[model samples]
Target: MPNDKNNKTELPRNPELTPPCGPVKGQYRKGISSYKGIPYAMPPLRERRFKAPEPMPPWEYLRDCLKPGHTALQMGGILVDSPGTYQMEGKSEDCLFLNVWTPATNPEERYPVYVFIHGGAFATGSGTEMMYDGTRMAQEGVVVVTINYRLGALGFLATHGLYEEAGTTGNYGLLDQIQALRWVQENIEAFGGDPEQVTLGGESAGAFSVTGLMLSPLAKGLFHQAIVESGSIFSIASFAPHNRGDLEKSMTNGQLLCETFGTRDTTEDLYKLRRIPGDVLAAVSMVKSDQSVTPKAFCFWPVYDGVVLPKDPVKALAQAEINPVKLLLGYNTNESSLFIKGHTNLGIYKMLCIEIFGPEKATAVMEHFPVDDDHTPLERMLEIYTHSAFVVGMVMMAKKYASLGEDVFFYNFDYDPAILKIVGLNTAHAMELPFIFGNGIGQHRATKISNLSWIMQSSWVNFIKTGNPNFKEEYKGQVLWPKFDPEKKDIMVFDTHLSNKALPYQEDLAFLEKIMFGNEESV
Candidate 1:
């Protein structure tokens, strides 16, 4: 067996496979052997054409698997602004790859595997990003695999228009995830992982994907447990009926924009758009504040494609129609404060007026999330966008899933107070990730190691291993997180210390629900 002693050493033999992608590496303080950038499916470019993910053929020679695959298309703002160690320089349509980290190559040990799907609203992100390195988790005695599925125009372009022969329609990216899971089921044994003990996990859109997988017939028996951070099955970004109109509008706008950007010219003209350099495509696809909240800026979200997605995720979970997978789901304290659009000082009502009714109705929106002289416009703005967009929606989804009698765990991540102060982003969208992964990310990161990070990471690992999250140590320092019960209405608030607090804003959620359901009296 190869050395599994420290983070600096490399693994010994690959008698099971071909030449390694890079020298085997270790990470964190724990001993884990890692192989990066292994392809799981055929790329979705050119002739592959919106078809379901096809199997990746084995290589005649050993393929070095050290580096990560190219990230799918996304804006450079996120990746470039805070680039990390695993950042690949470029992207391509042929980017169907995955990475693995394991404690040992001994198949008999059969460690439980943790698969992380990255989030960029399904239009961006990759398994290769440094934020998702599996070395720390692997050192903790779990095998970790990160994957890159297609994204942007390549991944979710809704091929129903041209590829009727394909078994699936929209959500090629999701189908790619299914194929990756299938790869793990069949081949992870070779990497010292037990396929039977797979756990699927993600954040933001990635967490939303986890929820999607739980309901997917294609993903059944592929995973045993799930962890969702700062996101839920019914998050307001773009998954539900209210958002469907937006997606349709976005798609129509996207098609028109693509045509404007020269992506359409008969079926023959489509090739020119596809052939456009990625940077150019990325430039054209960028969603800016200047764009109208119309179809052109479509969020490129997942759809309820009957073949792959089957039904609305919430409806599936509500009726006990989904696969019987255990779940750990939660949202951050201030998710919207991180991604606030337009000026930071606008009041909530004004922002909503801009988002839903456009700038012309800014005065009218103030009637709903009206501002006062006492509160700053930023405060009012944060309240409006955060409440309607993320916070209230997450709480409702957690409650809906808990009502099902399944073992659903809920949390609110309010940690990283120090980092929040540093970055002026209070517990924002992806702050919990570096804490959980704990691989020492960017230079400006707040790094006085918190026991809370350890606690949450261990809880995630425990859920992956045993389908339960009560760690032996969790009860030692904090309030033991009770399983979500509808009657008690208990939820664990994960911050400096864990607490089983009654939800503080039930009435606000009620107000949002009334608005959604058209209870005009309440509204």
Candidate 2:
């Protein structure tokens, strides 16, 4: 087994079919564990572009997974260079890799598996980031699987002619996720996991991916439980103005862009794009620093293909047409504020006006969220923006899930780290990840505020073990987390200490409900 820079000895050598290539050790758990990066499908380079994932050929030798496998090409050519972020060293067309974390000696323990999908708006990110390390969760008696799939234009471009030639397009990334779940269903039992107890969990775009899976008929029964963090149902209006027609036009526009880059002879020219450098392909994304480029204003995402997605997730979740799965969902307190750091309050008023009344209806929007004498446009902008994105919309989703008679658990994570509090980004989006994963340990500034890692992780583990997360009887540190109810609207507010409440932002939530499920003007 290989050793890290710290001189700690790793696990034993790979035995060809075992999960651990060497004994796995981490900050949380000490055990023999193998980290395997098994490829479940063929690469999507060259002629495989815009097609569904194909199964990979079996290999006889042991795959060296002491470290993470290759990551998919990050959209916009932006490398995943963030500290504490998951990353991969290599890139490839055949990058359908899945990483496994299991307890070292449990070849027969039958642990519950937690399959995670990383989020970067479906454009950036890999399962390789250190924050997503499964060793800690595996030490807690669960196997963790994180995977890499196509992103950006490579994953989400949709074309009618392309679909006519290829069976599918615009959703190859999602299909890859589906195929990974299928692979787990067929093979996770060999890795000491109860495939039937699989829980699909993710954040941001990953959370959206979970919803997409819930809506797809192909994904039914592949998973039983879901944990959606931060991201709620994406309404078509929020994402785009038109439906499939807009997506088709976008794809054709992308083809035209490729043509401008001297590859428009035929569809074969599209496959030739693989030979291009990473930076060149990245240049095609629409999210520029200046944000002036046209073509695809927003790049990468699963478009609504009638056969696969059938309809938008918001419509599906509202109608109860989504696949039945027990759900645990939550959002942060100040999500949108993190992005617009220095904006004035007046800017907030302008944004609300634009969203509610549109550019033409800005006058009406100004009436609702007005600017104060002391606040700037950006300051007001931050408040309304955060509320619109994180607080209000997510509450609507929780309410919908609870109304359907499903066992839904909801939370409002208001624990802001000291650094965030300094910048006024209190409990912004994705801030709760470290706490849930126990990464909040050892930090004197943040850790002193609260220690919810054990509670949060254990709660998740208990949920995987049993459909409900009420582990009060089995675990001592656990708190009483009741299922959500429409009438009482009980919720868990995570702060310096956890507390139960009727509704954190009851009035604002009612406004969101009127927009999402009631007959009222759009927000």
Candidate 3:
């Protein structure tokens, strides 16, 4: 017989694990209600493959939003029980679904909405990834919505005659994002969220999408705040062109892809290209995305299309016409290490550099990069690549936006688990996601990071609640977070103990800037 003192009540069911059986899409998990696999637009198929997203017809029945909808046909990077081994099972062309998590179902209650776009280089990735489950944010008294948009060749392949026929061509994925936002504008209120207070955010290519939405005239009035994580102008040619040319770069890549698929770069052939199965196109896109950075850049990223993207975002930021919204932007410390392959010897490193940059220029660059016992030649070059991809652009964009009288907050994600560091991926790209999303790191999961994760997610929730990330009243203690203005240059470092740090990496930044922008005479 159980004693009264030792008796324990059975725990209630996890709300997230329980999906509503009714037509209204929702599941109960953790104390939050989630609506999964809710379609935001009609599925892109057949002739609709490369065209703009058409409006989703209203379903008469209560659509069961129980399970996660299909992910777009993309390269597999799903984090299964282990970190890898993502099989393509449910991915399909009918992948324009979104998941919503909210604390309340009552329409009278209005919570701030956070819309997250997933990152996979604008090619692969779905909102269904467990890392982005909105239950955590929803539990914190905010609405968190994750979306799945189109990707790769089907989403970004541009054609001239198709443009003439459809009146809008590529960046259909971007348009899908816009439609999702539009759906939120129309329906989030019913989910107990305020459409007026929406924050658009993403990591990697998702972050690129956020920036694109920030500058897009179509997205002008849609979102009130923006968050960019590890996205910058120098990430790749597709995200940002090295030059200001419009369709030339994207068109060339599109042509190559067309040729590879046995379709010509002609108006009539575009019809044939559209007929290519979604799975086939997605497979080809995955192969193309693996191409080396040199030779021809073939990423299917959004071009500076006149319709979707009014102007080059980098150029637009330079002109100071970017929509004035409260912005929270950041990058990890060892971003380039995500792509760096470890080398056993310095000769191989030098040879690879010479191959990439050519002999003379490689020699000059090699001489500039220092190598020591602790910092290997490979590590030093990875630092340079890190500075090139994340740091330089973060500084430039932060300074530019802050100087323009818009509110900006900056941080550097430096917290990494020993397990990840053991594998040579310390504070690598998108490594901050688990901490940010309240999911602990793999194998290294413990209570040690709980406090730090709490602080970060709390600040994010507060930022969603209000433009400022500071929530002294909720903290039960005073916490000061300063803005990242040109004058102050203040940055918050997320690590063991939160502390403010002055901007670092000046010398490497100067050298890289000179290499990128300086002429021999100018120097």
How big is the positional error of residue 148 in model 2, measured in Å on the Cα after superposition?
1.2
Candidate 2 lDDT at 161 equals 50
Tell me the spans in candidate 2 whose CA falls farther than 4 Å from its real position.
Answer: 1-29, 75-89, 235-246, 249-256, 259-278, 286-296, 344-364, 374-376, 391-393, 443-450, 473-479, 510-523
lDDT of 3 by residue, 1-523 (tens): 1112223222223232222222465566665778888888888887778877887866667676778899988764422223232346788988899988887644467789999999876777889888998887777788899999998777887666566566656688999999999988988877778889999989888887887777788888899998888876334432334222246666666777778878887778877887777777776656222111332344577767777877766667667756678889888998766655575257755654554444666676677885777778777767766676567666667777788887889998888879878988788888888777886442223455777777778888878888888766654323477899685578888886677877777666666555543422110
Q: Which 10-residue window in model 3 sums to the lowest lDDT?
A: 1-10
Q: What is the C-alpha lDDT of each candidate?
A: 0.64, 0.64, 0.72
Pairwise lDDT winner, candidates 1 and 3: 3
lDDT of 2 by residue, 253-273 (tens): 556656666665255555555
Judging by TM-score against the true structure, name the best candidate.
Answer: 3
lDDT of 1 by residue, 257-360 (tens): 45666565244555554565555555544432221123244355566666677776656655677777677877777676665534555433354445543454
Evaluated against the true structure, the overall lDDT of model 2 is 0.64
Q: Assess candidate 1 and give its TM-score to the true structure.
A: 0.83
Per lDDT, the best of the predicted structures is 3
State every prediction's TM-score relative to the real structure: 0.83, 0.83, 0.86
